[model samples]
Structures are given as C-alpha cells and as structure tokens.
Target chain A: MSDPLQSWNDGPVKASIVEFVARVTNRGSSDHVPPAERIAVFDNDGTLWCEQPLQVQVFFALDRMKHLARKDPSLAQRQPFKAFLEHDLKTIASLGKRGAFEFAFMTHAGISEEGFDALAHAWLEEALHPKLGRLFKRCVFQPQIELMNYLRDNGFKTFIVSGGGIDLIRAVSEEAYSIPREQVIGSSLKTRVDTQNGILTLIKLSELGTFDDREVKVENIGLHIGRRPIFAFGNSDGDLAMMRYTLAGPGSRLALLLHHDDAAREFAYDRDFKLSPLSEALDKAASYGVRVVSMKRDWGKVFI
Target chain B: MSDPLQSWNDGPVKASIVEFVARVTNRGSSDHVPPAERIAVFDNDGTLWCEQPLQVQVFFALDRMKHLARKDPSLAQRQPFKAFLEHDLKTIASLGKRGAFEFAFMTHAGISEEGFDALAHAWLEEALHPKLGRLFKRCVFQPQIELMNYLRDNGFKTFIVSGGGIDLIRAVSEEAYSIPREQVIGSSLKTRVDTQNGILTLIKLSELGTFDDREVKVENIGLHIGRRPIFAFGNSDGDLAMMRYTLAGPGSRLALLLHHDDAAREFAYDRDFKLSPLSEALDKAASYGVRVVSMKRDWGKVFI
Candidate 1:
C-alpha cells in the first residue's frame, strides 16, 4: 500500500531527477530557475516505456496494414506490406529507412482526424504485444510516470518529443502521461480541411511531413515549444539531438539516458538493436557528461 | 494624464463588452464562472488591434518579399512576387486566392525559427503603417487590452485566435496582449528541420498548411484547446467558425462580431472588402443570435 513513487528502485537516478527538478522549481533557493524558463522534455518510447521487438508506431502501422490487406489484396504483394502480411519480421526489419517510411505513410493514410483518434484509443484498449502479452499502456515504466508527475508538481512544464506520429501519441498522452495534447510533438502526416455535405472535416492527407528524430527533434523543440528545455531524458540515439540541445542551453541543464542492461527485468539491447539503436549516442554520453543510467545497476526492480 | 482605457468612449458595445467580462470574472457574484469554464477568445487583427490597408501579416509578407527580392530578382518575376514587384495593388488584389496562397508560402519560406522571431520583433519595433505612422504594437485596442486584464483579474483565461502567421502572432502577443504565447492560435506554415554546418535549424518550408480560417478555426480550437470557449469576439468572416463552435458548447456562451461601420474613425467595409469580408457571415449572424456591434452607432471613439 506504500506509495510506489517513494520506493522507486532506481534511487540514485530518481533522486537526481527529483533534486534537479527541485532546484529548478525553488525560486528562493540558490539553484532556483524562473518559472518562464522551467521546461523539461522527455522521449516517449524506450525512455518512458518499452519499444522492444518493434515500436508502438510500427504496431499501429502493421495493424493498419492488416486491415488494408483484408480490403485490398494488392497490399499483400507491396514491398513493406508484403513483409508485414507474411509476418516476416526479418524482411520488414531489413526494409530499412525507405521501406519504413512508406509503411508509416500508407498505414496512416486517409484516416479522418476523429477516426484516427478513435482507432488509437480502441487499439490501446485491447491490443496486446506478442512478447509482453500486456496492453501497450500497461507496459509503461511506472517510475518514469512518477518522474513526469513529480516534474509537473514542481512547476516544470513537461513535453513528450517522440518519433511517433503526433496524432497517435496525442490520443493517449493526456490520459497516460498527464501531458496535454498540445505539449506532445512528433512526426506528422499532412492534413487538410474538406467540406462535404456542409460538414467540415479535417482529413489526413497522403503526404508525409517532418519525421521527429535526431536533428528534427531539436528543431521541433525550438519550433513548437519556442524555448529550450533545461532537462531532457531519453533512451536511444534518436534522442541525441534533444540531449545536445538541452545541454547546450545556458545555466543549469540535465540530460539522462536510460541504458537497457537488465535482460531479466527488461529487454537488454543497446547498440545491437535493429530499431532505435543507442550505439554512438551511448559512446558519446561519457564525453558529454550525460548520466548514462544502467538499468541493472540503477534499479532494484522494473515495473510496479 | 487621464488613463487611456478610462478616457475612451463608453458606448453600448464597449459597455456590453465590459459588463459581460465583469459578470464572468466576479467570483463571489452569481454570474461568476469557474476558471475551468471561464474561457474567452478574441480575434487578433481588428478586434485586438488594427488591421487597415493590410493585415499585419500582409506587411510581414511584403517585407519578407522585398528582402527575398533583393537577394534574388527571379523571385520578383513570380506570380505574387511579380504583382508585388510592380506595386500594383489592383493586380495583386486581382490575383485573389491563388495569389494570396502563393504569397503566404513564398514570403514565409526558408526562414529559420529563431530568425523568424527576431524578424518579427525587429519589424514590430521599427515598422510603421503608411497612414498610422505608429508602431504596430501601439495600434493594439486599448479597450480590449483593458478588458483582457480585467478578465484575467476576474479569473478568465484569454486567448488570441488569429489569421496571421502563428509564429508572428506569438512573437508579439505576449508583450502586446498580455496573453501567453501558447494561448495564441493562428495560421501556420509547414516547417522542417535542417542541419547547416554544425548547428540545427527549423526551416519554414514553402508549403501552405492550415489557414486557421472558417471551419479550421473550429477544428484547431478543439485540437489546440481541449475546452470550448464560453465567450468569443471576432470582426470578420474568418471568425464565424470559431463563434459557431463557441456558441455550440454546453453552457452560457456569448459571440460578438465587430461591424466596422465608422468610416471617419475606422475603415468601414463589409461586403466590398476582399480582406476579411463580412458579407455572408453577417447575414447569418442574426439567425445565430450573435451580437453584431456597429462601430458607428455603438462607439463614441475608435482607438484609445
């Protein structure tokens, strides 16, 4: 019955996060940061939740492909869709950047804004990962959720900057992370307004827009948030740009990257991971003085 | 020595605006609304500030075009640019929808996020309208500014819903209107991330995104602000969609449209003006029970 946040296993990491947040929030304290400058950004997937086997977005894409394949048999022969149709994880993984981009665009195409939200909500409600056998939402790291709440409680405006689709993350971010829809920035598909039968609808277009990754993440932070973050957390190379951006800011700054090294408690892969590899970023963490949190060394447990 | 807001005209329209704001902000009074429900949105251009001869955005676009034309004369030969180059207001006006769309894209293209904010601030500081000969920031509606503070003092969260560029509005909205940057919603151009040399940059692309007009305003209201506004003010057809959205919310809602009818004090044109015309929307205002304030009959003075 004790508070899970108070007994978080990763005491050192949690304490560092809490202490940094406290210093930033306390105006009277020497480390106090002004309210206008209290910005903290987090990477969603591996840092806050699990992204093993494939990303949540890849799951959404595959699901959409399955649905499309049922309606249009031609999708079964399409490059990425064919791999997805045959359950060829190897082939799909090897499809590389171009194939992945195509899959992402096609799967999310033609969905109405409302329809996409409903679909995301419905999928989260029932869909279970093959490896975890648990709903995607349930797989979220409890400690990270607590950390987000703690930051919010201390007046730090928290945001999720991810490579996932903006609409997809927005659908559940408010409910799951307490991050408002507006505060979530991610890759986006093009959208347009269409009036049909006098009813105006915001329709998802077939064009792909910016992908929130590495350099794009840093650019988006400036574009959308309009301020540099003082604190940033991530778990992969995809987050390197954000970490660099945060560290480059004046005055107090903190960057923490979670290194998955506990195979029993969580999936253990860093440089070898096909998706979201942390190789070069992990190597540079030491030079940048970013705290590289080893899951095995830092945490006494994994989930709540 | 007199207070500008206090010395300004107190006609039926201004009185109504003040009275309605007072009722909503009075916490102990029966008309007091809770902070969660006390939402008020104002149109940016004319309602919150002046938009005569051209909108503030048109000025920014023209300046941007001139700057670009200096660097590349080929740009001056383009459709909108060519019209801009000839200084032919008639031809520019004749180009109409297509011309405006092209101008919006080209004028905003390739500017870095930081550069855009700096440009906006610089222009606002030095640029003066040809006739007004006053800083654009000085042209803001004093009565409305006072009303904004009064509403905030009374617990209402004020927002600026505008048709100007989102970044441009956000740049000056905080200083000019006292509304937070996040509370300002406006038309947005597409942007992407780029890395030049070693520094990361957010570059505005030559793509026209949502115009935040008519129905898109309603859609963006729902997208950006989860809660529906209880009170809204607008001066043109661009705001009809937002007014409709606000009025449809489940509560006591007020929608007011400022009808510019005082030629001496302010430019008066409804159906004739190409920019922000009030033709068809004005006709439907009566059926919707939207309050229409005629500037000539409802106000004693124009600016503070």
Candidate 2:
C-alpha cells in the first residue's frame, strides 16, 4: 500500500539527493533554481545498474561472437573472436582496453542498424546477470532510478554519460531511466547511409570513434549539453571528470560518488579492477568536497 | 513584385517534384500517400549547397593546420600542415583521398569541442565561396530548400545525409535547410569525456570513425532513421549508395542525381575532379533508372 520510494532508507546520501531536488524545484523557497540551470548528470553502469565481473556491453559482444561462430568456424580462430568463441573470459578480459574494443567492433560489425537495435532490446528483456539471476533491466539501481525521476520532476534535465555504446544505452534508457535518447551520451562507431529497394538503411563500421571515459566525458558534456550541469553522480573514477565538470559551474553544485565497499550485498573491487577502476579518484574525493557515499551505510537494499 | 518560385522556370524535373508533393499531400488526390511512407533524403554539399575546390570540412582542416603551425613550429614542416601553411591548395588537393583525410585529422586534432564549434560558426558567417561571392549560407540552393519544405508539408520527414561532420551540419542546418539536428547524418570523429577542475568536457577525437561515403551512407540511414526513404536527391557518386537503397525499398520511389553540367552557372566536373567523383556512378545512373538532371536544363538559375 505504501510507495517504494518512500520506503527507501532514510540516510544522509538519499536525504541529500532529495533535499537538493526539493530546494531546486520549490519556487516559493529561497533555493529555487531556473529551468536552464537545472541540469543533472549520472553515470550509467554501476551507478544506475549492476556492472560486475563483466560490463553489459562486453556480455553482449560475447553473446554475438558465439552467435557468429556457429555460422562461421573461421571466427573461432580469429584473435578476439577466438577468445569469444571458446568462451574464454580470461583471455577476452586480458585483452584489456584494446581487446575489449576489438571485441566490440567484431561483435557489432555487419549488423544492420535495425537488426542491432532489435537484438539489443531482446537481450535487455531476456538476458539475466550470471549471479543476479534477474533481467539486466531489473538490475537497475532503485535509488538511482528514484533519484533520476525526482530530479526530472523538479525541472532537472537528467543525462546519462557512460563509456557504453551510445545506441545500446539509447535502446532501453528511456524506458528504464526515463532519460530521452538524445540525452544519453556514450562512445559511438561511425555509420553510413544505405538506400536499397526503396528502403533507407544505416550500416555500422568497424572504425572506432570516441571512448566516453575520464576527461572525454567532461569534454562530451560541454559539446553535447553546452552548459555545465549543477549536479552529478557516479560510482567510479570514469565519472570523476563529470563530477569535476559539474562542480566547476558558476553557481552552487553537488557531486556524489557511490563507494562500493559493501562486499556482502554487491561485488567490491576498487584498486585492482580492470573495468570501471575507482582508486585514484576515490583518494582525491575528500579534497574536492565530493560527498563519498558508503553503499553499506547509505543504501537500505541492493536492488528493488 | 512576383514570387520567385511561381515565376521561375518549371521544367519536367521541377514539375515532377511539384506533382509528387501535390499527390502525397492531397487527401482526395489519386496518388495520396500514407504518412509512414513519406520519407525524403537530400545530399548536403553541392546538392544542397556549393561544394567546390574543396569541401567545407577540408577547408576547416586547412585553416586549423595554419592555426596549429603558429603554436607548434614543427607542424609547419609536416606534409599536410606544410601544404596548408604555404597556401598551396594545389598540393593539398593533389593528396587524393588519403592525403585529404590526413589533412582533416591534422586540422581537427587537439582542439577542444567548444573551441571547434566557435571557430566553425564564426568562419561560416563570414567566409564566401571563391565563385559564389556570397556568404556560404546564402549560397544554398533556393529551389532545393523549397523542395525540402514542400516535402515536409506533404508528410515527408526530410533529412540531410552528408559527407561532412554531423556536428558542423547540426550547427546551422535548421536555419539553412530547415532540417532538424537529429535528422542530419554525416561523417564524424570519435569522442571522449574528460573532467578538469571538477568540470566535465566532451573531447572530439583526432581519429576517424565512419566515412559517410559510397556504401556507408546507406548503412547510416538504416541505423539512424530506422526506415527506408521514398525520395532521394544527390549530386555525386558518394550518394549512389543512398539512392540505391531508396530505390530498393518497397512501393513507388524517386531517385534523382543533379549533374553539374551547367558550367556558366555552376562549376561542372565529374571524372576530371578528385573531389566528389561521380564518373562511374553517373555512367550507371541511366541503367539504375535514376533521373540524371542536367543543371543547365533543369533550372533557370543556380544560386538563390
């Protein structure tokens, strides 16, 4: 009978987020903010949903590689494709940045734009996290979803800036987080226009474009959003640039970082994780006056 | 005073365009078209505006090379930079495709995203084509602009499929052509996110992603628009793929190629010019049933 958002644990982090939204939205109150200045940004992966052991995009690539290998044995012998065909997560993970990128190109290449979106949507609806046993969409953080809506309801234009594929995020972001497709920022590949048989088609290229990570996120914010956001939230170092950018704006700002210290409810790896590393940035959070949120203390539950 | 559109010559090509619009927009008309099938695409560059000597993006790159050389003396000696600095348009033009691309990277690299947009906008407002003697925006084809609006009024979603930078097209596309930013497809560089002093910035990569030429244009249309267009207009072989894709789609379709045969009004070059080569495609247009419009016979005037 009660609202799930109201039942969320009353803690400093949640309280701070709600308080900021209330202040910005309340026109009769002193802290009222104008629509143009009401910008809020969020990091997607761990901040909005579970990103552990492997990123969602990596999983999608692996699945696609397997699908291709069934059709062509040659793919099983290729470099990253070989790792992907053999289900060798270690080799694929070891490929690090370059390997991951190569895997992305191989997995996504040759797919018609329409076909790719259909596959992505199908995967989101059916695929479950290996450990979570829940639909990838369901694994979204309840607190963050609540936070996004709360901000949006208060006149804030929320955006998701991630290192994931822009199209992949755009596929389900609007449904899950209520962020419009245009507002989602991420790395993207080049596309070409094709018209055959009175049909317009967009083809994906193997060429890599931008990787929306670290300082690039900051640069993308300035390029796409134009004005700086007054509020930001993230769970890792990749988000540090965005946090810094938000705080650098002219007026009052808020930056909050979720520290995954709770190993009991969720996976915890800060210093040694190859994907979504958060060590160096975590060390400097205090000096920047960024609110460091302890997952164990701040969140009442891991997932809705 | 008389309206130019009414008084201007209405040849078979222009008459065909007008006839199609009337049929699609008229509910009681025999050729009434459904809204879902009303899709139209236009090639940017010479088809929509003048692209001679070099594409505007290449010009931007050359300008950037000069700017970069001022700060880094070593750049003055580099292949593209050296050619750009010495005002040797001949040498730069002779570099062919690879050389042209190299010039693009050298010119676009290292500048901040905001810095690039500011530079592009400022140059566009002041610069004039060597032949047109009018501001670049003013040189847009008046007939084509009217055609786009006519198509939109008839339930068609008109789009600009370009070989230029997507961001650059998005900058002034609405004012110049009435095409929305989201509908402009073009070549692009990679992007990354960066944070500095607690501020987020999006940086455009020096690397190339997809070149929206040949087959890539068809692929991009499928990726972005999610539908096949029913009408397409182009000026070069770079747009052949798009025209092919459009003609391949179901139902009645129209594909037009604007041949720059009018030397006195507009520069006429196909096989002889390295930029926007159209010899092979032009030869095949007849077999493909594509209407090859002679600029000399198709219209009364060239520029608006």
Candidate 3:
C-alpha cells in the first residue's frame, strides 16, 4: 500500500504510532480495544496546525476588534483591544491567555451564533499568516493530517480537544483536519437563545463558561466525550493533563508531544510562547512515557 | 423493506416523520441536506423514556440520599434528603428541580468520574420502574427508538439533548437509544482533575454548569454539535426552544413533542408534573408546526 504519512520521515516516533495502532486494532490481540472505544484526541493550535506569531484565532479576534473599533472608536482605547489594534504582541502576551480570552468575549459576544460562525468562516477564507505567507486554514501540519487519517482508517475516532474557541476551531476543522464539528472540543462562552424575525436565534454572551486548558482539558474531555481517549497528542503544557489522562486509562495507551524545532520550515517557539508555554511537558514527557516528536527531525515537510 | 416504525400506528405523526426524512435524504431534491449536516436531536426523560413518578435520575438520587442517610443520620434531617427519605414526593416536587439537581451535585460530586459511572451503571442494572415493572433502561418508548433508527438509516446523526444530568443519561443512552456517549448533551456540573496514586483522576464539583433546558438546549446544540439540527423530538416546555430552533433552520425540518397521555399503558402527567410541566409547548405546539406525539393514540407499545 502507498504510504499514508508521506510528510513523515521513518523515525522512532512514527514507528511507535504505527505499532500502537496495529496492536490495538488487531482483533485477536490482548491489547485490542473495540472500535467504539478507540478514541484519540488532538490539540489544535501547535499540534495539528501552526500557532506561532499568535494563534490563528487571536488574529481573527484582532481583526474583529479592528472592525468594531472602526464603528466605535472607544473599543480601540480598551486594554486588550487597544493592544490588539496597535499590533503590540508584547502587551497582549503580557495580558497572556486571560487578555486573549477577554478579547474573545468582548469581540465575540452579542452576535447571533450563526452570525459568529459566518464571521469566522469569512475571516479564515481570507486571513493569511504573515510569516508563513499561507492562508491560516492552509497552515496545518501535513504529517498530523495523515496520522489522524491513519488512526481513523484503523477504527479510531479522532477528536480535536483544544484550548482555542470551539466555534473558531469548528469553522475550519472539517476542511483543515477532516474532523467533523461534533468531534471538536474547545473553550466556550455561554450563549442565550431568543426569537428574531420569527426565527429562533442564539446569541453569544460575554460570559466565559469553560476554558479548556491543563486540568480543565481533562474535565471537558470527560464531560463532552464521556470516554477516556486511548491516545492523545499536543505540543504545550496545556495538553499535559490530557496526555496523562489518556495514558492513565486501563490497558495499552499512547501519548505524543510535538516539539516545534523546525523554524526553517515552520515557526519554532515553545516554553517562551507565553500564550502556551511548554517547559514541564517537554521535561517530564519521558517520565510519563510520552514520545517527544521533533518536527525538524521527524517531519519531511511542514504544511501541505 | 419491513416497517422501520412498526410501533408507530398509522397516523399523521408517523406520515409526517417518514415524509420529512425522505425529503431530507433525497439527494436530487431541493430539501435534501448533505449527510454531514443531517442532524437530529432528542430530549430524554419523558420524550425518550418514562419520566413518570419522577425522572429516573431523581430516583437514583433518592437512593443515594437513602444510602448516605444511613451513615450520617443528620442527612435525613436535611430538607431535600429529609423529604427524600421520608418518601415525601409532594414536598420533593414542591422543592422541584432545584432539590433534584442539588441532590445530583451532592451525590455525583467528589467521586472520581469513573467511580460515578460505575455507580450509575450499577444502579441502572437493577433499578425498575415503580409502576411499569420494567428495568429503568428498558422503559424507553419503542416508537421513538424505531424513529431514531429510521433517521440514522436515512443519513442523519442523532443526539440526545436533555434537561437531565449528562452523566446519568449517558450511562444508559447507548443501551436504551443506541446513541453514543459523545452525542448525548445534558445538564452538567463543573469537574476538576487531579493525580491519584500517579493515575489521573477527575472529580465532579458541586458547581452547576450548563443546565440544558429550553434556550440552553439550543445554545448547547450550537456549541457541541456546531450545526443546526433539521429534526428534534422532545417533551415538555423545557424542549420548546430546541424544537423551534430545529425548525428554524432552512430547508425541510420537523419537530415533535411527546404528550404522555397513555394512562392505561403508561402514567399520564403533564402540566402537573411540576419538575417538567408541559403546558405552553402542548398548548402552542401547532403554531410553530411542531407535531404533538400522543403516546396513547400514536404508539403501539410503550416499551420494548
């Protein structure tokens, strides 16, 4: 058969992934998990796609802020929006995830759910990564796509469990990762329903409901998926809990962490990327039996 | 082909359901929806299974309260637990859903997620309907099951969007409705994750999160499913928003509300049910084009 993971070089990381799928999928093997229970979750930003130079959603939110500021100049004077409008990544990073999430709530709320989805879809259609010179949707890692496809072909259900906005990830998830909207789990704001023009309408509220990160990632996985995934992949400290949670499930499990050291091909910023620092995960990955995949060494190419 | 809905008697409800499915699944038709977008959501409790005497989870919570009261007698002196242990359904009803949810948080919290699942799975195995003389898991309406199966066979993805606790419904959803755990959406409590004996552990918290009812059901469907469902089946006013939301989507749509008027075969209670009073939905179901499912008239059997 033709190679499924064409973008992946033959390496220990790829070998381990292949071996794990083979063992779990072999019906007569003791490690065999029923197809329904073969759950695998993945982190979106750094693991599945590029997140450097700010997460793609941050850029989307920044653009939304710019548009809103144009209509009401007062928005540009606000803290996060002000930082966003000035293109001051340092100030926004100083605000960290809290600042980004606050921006998400302010820029995302009060719009109809359908309206918000349309906005995201339109932004992704045109938005480009300044550094990569590629559309944000086109910036996904090619090897990860194949890995997900391979897992799915071997009877595993793949899900995106990320700290990014659920609505934002879902807009491009299906096309970018071939993952359905229902299989994507992410941070969310509470929304309310109302009737408009005799049509039922759901409007986003500024209330931050759940932030899927670290411990909350595991909690949300438990709540939304209701099954412990057998395999998990990520590239930051935010995904460490999920990685540990997946491996802790009874029976054979596998967890992998991505190391973005391929700055020549793609951006390489970790542990210092204030939004999603990754020091402990990289340090403790070996102790937890998590395989650390070096993008520079393991990937033959970055984006497809 | 044999009848997919044999339990559904010859009626307008059955005809409408079949016709809607046909139109949506017919590829060449204008009403046809792409299989990926063919979403269907059902309300649990009175709609999918019997909720008479009290919701099934309330009984489970009452049992938990009894067990806890045995160890701590002072718990029997408390309001909801006192009412529960004294077999005071009237007071419990007057205390209403607030009391039941409080009991859920207490009984469901502090335990490991897996531990609670075991408890629910164990309880469901032995618990019987007080009046129906059948296991709680077996008390589902056969017509609804057949209808869901029919929808799935016609390329629709079916999900349970209930006002009941998500964890409780998930325990029996697969066995009862053939729905997967990930497809079930319901009321939830926030959970926290920790490490126990080097194993990842998720503990449920007393804090209530999304109480999936009325408007929230629509919002959750938007968040989790990320696509508007073309079909929705529900019972009580708690589901009216979901029904309207489903029909509000463009193209062929259908929504049905269950009217539990089958006194001879099943308990008949509506506006008086208190916890899930079915007044406005029943009174105005027709104006929104929602069909009322009369269990006494349309159904051939109440349970499999």
Please report the candidate that would top DockQ against the real structure: 3
Residue B290 error, candidate 2, Å: 4.5
Chain B structural similarity as TM-score, candidate 3: 0.97
lDDT of residue B168 for candidate 2: 74
Note the DockQ of each predicted structure.
0.24, 0.24, 0.80
lDDT of 2 by residue, B110-191 (tens): 5555556688788888877766788777778776876777677667888888887777776678779877555688776766
TM-score of chain B of each: 0.89, 0.91, 0.97
Across residues A1-304, which tens digit of lDDT does each residue of candidate 1 receive? 6543653554667677767876777777777887766888999888877888777777878888889889999878877678777767777667653356456765777776667888989999988978888888777876788777777777778889988778878877877887877778877776665543443455677776667888888766765666778899999888987898787655677999999998898899988776678987899998886888887877665664
Q: Which candidate do you rate higher for DockQ, 2 or 3?
A: 3
* Cα RMSD for candidates in order: 5.4, 6.5, 1.5
**How would you class the docking of model 1?**
acceptable
Candidate order by decreasing DockQ = 3, 1, 2
* lDDT of each residue in B1-304, candidate 3, tens digit only: 8899999999898899989888988889999899999999999988898888888878898888888888899998888778888878888888766556666567777777788889999999999888888899998888888999998998889999998899898888888888999999999888888775667888888888778888889888988898999998998999999998888878999999989887899988898988889999999998989999898999998788
- Tens digits of per-residue lDDT, candidate 3, A185-212, equal 9998878888656667888888987788
lDDT of 2 by residue, A97-208 (tens): 4458555765686666667879999988898898888888887877677677767767778888888887788888878887766578787676655442444566676776
Cα lDDT tens digits, model 1, B18-87, are 6776676676667677775688888898788888766777777788788888999898887767776666
